[model samples]
Target: MVVLKMKTISLKVNGITKEITVEDNELLLNVLREKLGITSVKAACWRGECGLCTVLLDGIPVKSCMTLAVETDGKEVITAEGLYSDERAKKLMESFVKHGAMQCGFCTPAFVVTSHYVLTKNPEVDGEELKKELNGVICRCGTYYQIYEAVKDAEKYYKKETKS
Candidate 1:
């Protein structure tokens, strides 16, 4: 008889270092929410389409549901919780709130994570480019228009902040 043991790995999630033992088949999203107790990364469409499980893997947006737990070993994973205090994130949240970009709140985390990637990568992005970048994320609450507007406004906010 052969026995398989779960692998223990270390990862820095949301700026915190954690060591966890996970099964080979475990997804990063599950580990994050269940094991690490970080519920900000919501699990919606388990399939990579919802974008609700989005997270920052070394500053690039990735679908946590499709990512393997072991693959995050020794890497940095930033969740929506980590962005709560970030200036850019603050601006995004403010814009979203003021522009009515968030409705049900299920998809906001993904949009925030994805927007972080977009705005940080290019603060000068126009509405068309912002919409194109956010194409992969599906918001079931029908807040696409307001979401796009929020991203555009966030870009302008960040640009002004950086210049001064």
Candidate 2:
């Protein structure tokens, strides 16, 4: 009998370092939601077109569905929950709630992840450019207006140095 080889990957998720053993072909989305109990990284659109599976890989927005679990070795993988520890993210979440950005909450995590990156990286981005940056995610609730407002409102916090 042949044994399927499993690879052990060490990575930081939601500010916690975890070592998980997974099959060589497992997707990061599966690893996050199934093996790691990170349901915020949505499993929608397994084909990689949906932004519901978004996560921050070293502060850059990435689609967890397309990323391989083995590829995350030694990397920092942050989910929506991970953002809470950072002041900038907390403000953004507040803005999202204040603006009523999320309806179903299925795709909100991806928007939060993407918007956080854009805002923190460049606090002065205009509406058009900000829209471009957030164009990757698909929101079925048609809450783009509120989402954009949330990101825009959160820009004020990004202008300052956030506390860790």
Candidate 3:
């Protein structure tokens, strides 16, 4: 008989710290979406190809579907909901709406989070690099042009942070 081990882990999500027990082999995507009820972390293409479940792990973007819940213990995981207080993220979201970057909205959160990471790292990221960086996330709605425009429009907000 095989029994899965339950492990207790503490992870900070969207600035809130949560301590929960999870099966040893549970995926971080399940932990965030199922246990924590973070619906923004969508579950699609479980193999991590879709990037719909991307989350920031200690300020770096990672595919939660490919990450183990246990590995997030004591780490900070930021989803779209968590970026509310961030000016850059806020601007990016606004731009997304204004530019009509999302359609159907399933992949919006992941694009926002990943785009936030890209802009945070380099507000002046060029078109090719931006495309390469966002290649992981797939949008079936084919709003790539609009998404690009939104990110570009929000570049000023991200740049403002660097100057300050």
Indicate the residue-level lDDT of 66 in model 3: 97
Q: Write the per-residue lDDT of candidate 3 for residues 1-164, one digit (tens) a residue.
A: 78878888999999998888988889999988888899999998999899999999999999999999999899999999999899779989999999999889999999999999999999999999999999999999999999999999999999989999
Show pairs that collide, candidate 1: none
Report the lDDT tens digits of candidate 2 across residue range 27-94. 99999988888888888788878788999998788898899989989999998989989988998999
Ranking by lDDT: 3, 2, 1
Runs of candidate 3 with Cα error greater than 4 angstroms are: 1-3
lDDT of 1 by residue, 1-164 (tens): 55767999899988888898988789999999998898889998899988888999999999999999999889999988898878878888889888999879888888988998899888998778888999878988899999988888788767876789
Model 2 off-target regions past 4 Å? 1-3, 162-164
Leading candidate by lDDT:
3
Q: Cα lDDT of all candidates, in order?
A: 0.88, 0.89, 0.93
Count of steric clashes across candidates, in order: 0, 0, 0
Q: Which stretches of candidate 1 lie over 4 Å from their true place?
A: 1-3, 161-164
The TM-score of predicted model 3 comes to 0.96
